[model samples]
Target: MVKLKIGILGFGYWGKKIYQALRRIPECEITVVCDKRKIPLDNKKIILTDNYKDLLRMNLDGIIIATPNETHFSLAFQFLLKGYNLFVEKPLATSFKEAEKLINLAAKRNLNLFTGHILLYHPLIDTIKKILENKKNLELKIKRTNKVSQINKSEKEIIYDLFPHDIALLLYFFKKEPKIKEIALEKSLVEAHFLIDNEIKISGVWGKGTDKERTITFFVENKKIVFDGLLSVLKLKENGNEKIIKSIDYQLPLSWELSYFLNSLKNKRIKEKIPTLKVMAVLDKIEKLL
Candidate 1:
């Protein structure tokens, strides 16, 4: 078996999880781990570096950019130029232009570039997509929150940090980009209401809260299904009866997403354009509402 030599940038929160997931795959080997802050690795086999340029010189098949939002475009562009398949953490880039450039690079070189939209890999989201495929009656409500307002200090606006996960799911189930009906913005919080194909209502709130809640709810024809991260279970309702998809799987979503990207890298067919630009475009519109 040919092990893929993988380099990961950013050893922060999600970056650490990516490291753990990649280690579980027998076909993967962590070539180097880079971050602004020094990170201690238990595996002495993996080289740790603070300078990302050091990674460019390493022999690696692909690099995963798990850095901050503002740094995503530059880091991804750099590695892509060096001829490595890229797994970029979500919200692709801060702007549509940056996203377009990355996509174009991938197209020109035939290298695979994947956005880290972990929610799309959720089994619950997959089941929901099948149930709501092209259905205009569905209503989506998503909220991603922190316990306090001052906690997050990343360069990304709270909306960009959180909403892409929900938006990816929205685009999948609705099969179209929903029009923004209204947007309410604050310094660190945002509420955007969207109408999908002039039918479904999808509303999202991304920001801090006095209480913590990360939930996605879908309503259709007197029935609703909710995947609640807070409760760690999926709730379903229909015909006056209720069912629970008790205790979501323990497997890491990043692992599944990486596995898919690695396997799909060999297939040359481009079914549709990468959705990074679209995600950035929607984010742009939401930012304008601020």
Candidate 2:
């Protein structure tokens, strides 16, 4: 059996998770890993280096960039130019222009360019999306709160760091571009209101607090559906009664996301291209608003 040679850049918190997921795929061979700091690994066959350019020499089938947001554009661009498939951790790029360039170049070379929007691959999210389809007059409220220490670890501002997940979810759920009707920032907290397709309303709040919370609430007429990331469960409430709709299994979203990327590479197709671009464009608008 042939194995796909994969090189991963950055071995930080998220990078390590990507490595763990890629390891479980039978068809994937992690050829090289790059990081600024030394990473101790038990596998002697996998190449570990501190420089990313070394990955270029390995003739990798795909390169996953889990580096800082600022480096995503440059590293992905270089790898795409070399005609390797890419799996970039989301926001794809810091700006829409950079994201568009990478996408266009990948299309020109007939390579797969995937963004790691992990939430889209979540089992609970898929279940929620199916329940909300064809429903009108819906309202979405997502509050993503993190500890100050956790927030400090990110190189991006509060908006850039936390807003993309909810925004990506909105785009996926509504299947329409949103208009930023209002935005306000106070210290580390960011609050924004969006109108989607002139029918649905989205209110998003993200920032640093003492506690960490990841909750998504949907109001469809009199029914309410909520997905709690921390608990990995989905619930529905109506007429003052609530019930559990679904509980996710042990499978992690990162594993699902990596599997999708590998499958796309095997099939030689770029799936989710349009939705990824739409998320980037919305992020660009949000950047301009700030």
Candidate 3:
């Protein structure tokens, strides 16, 4: 079998993880890597460029975009229009219109378009979802806070950048859009709070002079499962008794997601994968409320 040549755009914080994972995949070869600014060389094998158009000249099977939220639509548009398979980072795009455009284009081209919703690949999260399925009723609370960034961003709120993970997870586990009964939002240039789904509430703060604190809690019939994201541990409680659930110390999520994508590309159609149009539609609704 011929190995698929993979090109990654935006070799920034999260992109490096996906780049590393692509290197590890035996079926895919990391032929090109591009970033807007100069990045230090991680491996000599990676052909680095500042311009993404340079990548199109090379024979490429797929492209992964880990750039800023705003660039997702335009960059993906360029590549998917050329008929290359794509792995786009979360939220699909900054808006529902762009997401739908990308989806429709990918479908028309009969190419794979996978979202980088890495949480969907987390085994521990999947376990929690299974446990919640057996319960009668539940409410979820997701708290995500991080220290302020030195970099300036246009989409300068936590809701747009961070809450997508929670939104994607809620849609995945609940399997339907819950009536967003009410929303309480406190907005600033950097931070925001969104209380969504009458039962499920999410509080988010992202800006300067803050330490990282991420926690997700699920409350249900006689049970509670709290996810401490920073610590990467889950605390489980049943009937008011609490115990910590150990997460399987695993490799990075992008690697798992890429591996899954590889298998899906080989064995299943792109539409069959998680975070398909169905999932993106739910995200569109959540984006509106955000």
Per TM-score, what order, best first? 2, 1, 3
The candidate, 2 or 3, that scores higher on lDDT is 2
Q: Give every collision pair in model 1.
A: none
**Candidate 2 local lDDT, 231-284, one digit each (tens):** 889999998999998887545888988998998988998678247788878878
- lDDT agreement of model 3 with the native: 0.71
CA lDDT of every candidate: 0.78, 0.85, 0.71
Per-residue lDDT of model 1, residues 41-148, tens digit only: 878899999999998888887788998888989988888888888888887888878889999998888788888887777666677767776566668888887777
Q: Which candidate leads in TM-score?
A: 2
Q: What is the TM-score of each candidate against the true structure?
A: 0.91, 0.94, 0.85
As for TM-score, the candidate ahead, 1 or 2, is 2
Ranking by lDDT: 2, 1, 3
Q: After superposition, which runs of candidate 2 have C-alpha atoms over 4 Å from their true positions?
A: 153-156, 239-241
